[model samples]
Target: MRVRDVRAYPHRVTAQLFSLEALGWDDSWRELASAYDGCGDPGRIVRVDRGLFGVATREGLVRASLGGAVLDALAKDAGAAPCTGDWCVVREWCDGPVTVEAVLPRRTAVTRAEAGGTSRGQVLAANIDVAAVVVALHPEPRLARVERLLAIAWASGARPMVVLTKADLVMDADLIAEDVRVVAPGVEVICCSTVSRRGIERLGAMSGEGRTIGLLGASGHGKSSLVNALAGAEVLAVERIRADGKGRHTSVRRELVLTPGGGSVIDTPGLRGVGLQQAETGLSSAFPDIVALAQQCHFADCGHEDEPRCAVLEAVGEGRLAVRRLDSWRALRREAASMGTRSAARRRRALGKRPRRLATRQRETRRGVGR
Candidate 1:
């Protein structure tokens, strides 16, 4: 139940990390945590909800809270806030609650633009090695949605693997995977059927001890079943897809679980929006084919709208590239570009730039300065 009884002794903290390597700790973490040596115990944040958090340390899983000072620092830098899969330092500890002093640098994080009318960025999962974009084949794969997730995954600095789930539901899974591959460019497309264990081994092979993989998808996409299948047991709850192909959220929060496959898996609730947070490099990485085509265009900065000799437009017209794919790329590019502008304005404001409201500029002298 509770580990509070053991908090009186500091030795338990080291015991909790006995399996730290199984949770993604390695020589790198030890090296980065050098400065924090003896300051506090090391832990990995497994989940966060409301203001409470579940942190896994060498002592054991401890219920923790961010100290006021640590919270203040993270408020100014959302990127440093604790998320599932963050390596952290617990300076003070008790059985009832532990105090998180600091969060270490993330090796990779799956970030999305905050939804609900916010320009801030939200980190979904941190220190992940693989961003698995899960899609189901029951109805049909949503290529546009896959592209958007791929963009976020690419921007996260982790390798993206497009996992097409529910392969048993489709007769031509390979054909559908090929269709998705055209839009995904360099990303791996795995056709996995939890029912048949089709690509489960391959997926497991990619995950080993000391590695972390994140599962990303929408509801009714069978992300739950896939996660359970990967763990080789029912580590999560699941529900059948409704007749309309929509299902209620099986996972209410992002959580990390140790997989029997020898790595940790972060199971995240289906996202309502895969908003881009100024991911220009992600756009290019996700749509390498289109970027390569543009590089061959007569004008270096061709918008591919109506420019003569536009290779992208030429491909779409020739059926070599689907119009839908090109449209998706353009839409994400425009969104990221708009977000970049807003981010720059926010930076300027933070730097004490004058507000446009009462600021005045010099008027040119045309006939007279007053005129």
Candidate 2:
């Protein structure tokens, strides 16, 4: 495989590879892309495990570890990590192990709040063009959850689509479609069933040639099953949720699989709880209807709790909107804003510590001189 061949995968990957090459890569891939000029192999990270990553290079699949300079760059830029779909530069020597020297810039990245109530954003997939938010029909579909996922999908700097799984199990597809429309109004909503193969063809068309789509949903939502069905083979493992309807983490890692017709899909582990970190823009965009209503509120900073002429409350009272949807939006908005503030504070403290330590060192030097 060659560097030019690897660049043909997708727009995001192609752009990143070209950008790195234009910047003149050398021994180290720094922010400015100046590195030691030598032979560099291009690859996309498929999975990261035990401090090693599975990179699909032009030469073939190879396991590689990050070099010292790359690790230092990651430490400087917290957002820079080897995520699935990221186009990276690798050094492969026959006599030694391969090392990831640099990760190219991403055109689009899907990020969400860490599920553990952490004030940090978790990059789910990088350099993806589309995000297919999957939801199952079993155990009663939660529209609120769908809305939440849509918000994150939109925030990821990628196009968002809703994929309703297990459509064959539900008797009335129209009803489910109506419920989904409330949250993802203009976005495409696909109904599919692995058993019946309903809407599979349409789903394939939406992905387009050479584009990458990411699958995201809670466990038992049939994400892996859908991936297997689309691939026409059992590339991913499938497992049944518990009797109580809770899903087990069958897909332990995120991987990109090629589709038979065209394009690729990334299947990730089922997310139990999705947090809203650094997604304020995505939240407002996902629920534009609610945001527009809030704009008409009497107070500019109204909490919508007991504000006078609250347009949001008025709409809910008039049956134009669901109360639960508004509640969910408010909850997520507050959480996202709070998380952003906390993260900013932490960064400030960390930065402040460095200056304080420097000042202390200067004082100690003066004291030593006086003594």
lDDT of 2 by residue, 223-292 (tens): 9998898888999999954665554688888887777756677888888888875588788889889888
For candidate 1, lDDT tens digit of each residue in 33-61? 88788768888888788866788876687
Per-prediction TM-score: 0.88, 0.85
Considering every candidate listed, which one attains the maximal lDDT? 1
lDDT of each: 0.82, 0.77
- Worst 10-residue stretch by lDDT in candidate 2? 15-24
- Report the error of model 2 at residue 99, Å: 1.5
Candidate 1 Cα outliers beyond 4 Å, as residue runs: 1-18, 94-96, 240-245, 349-371
lDDT of 2 at 114: 73
Instruction: Judging by TM-score against the true structure, name the best candidate.
Output: 1
Task: Please give the TM-score that candidate 1 achieves against the real structure.
Answer: 0.88
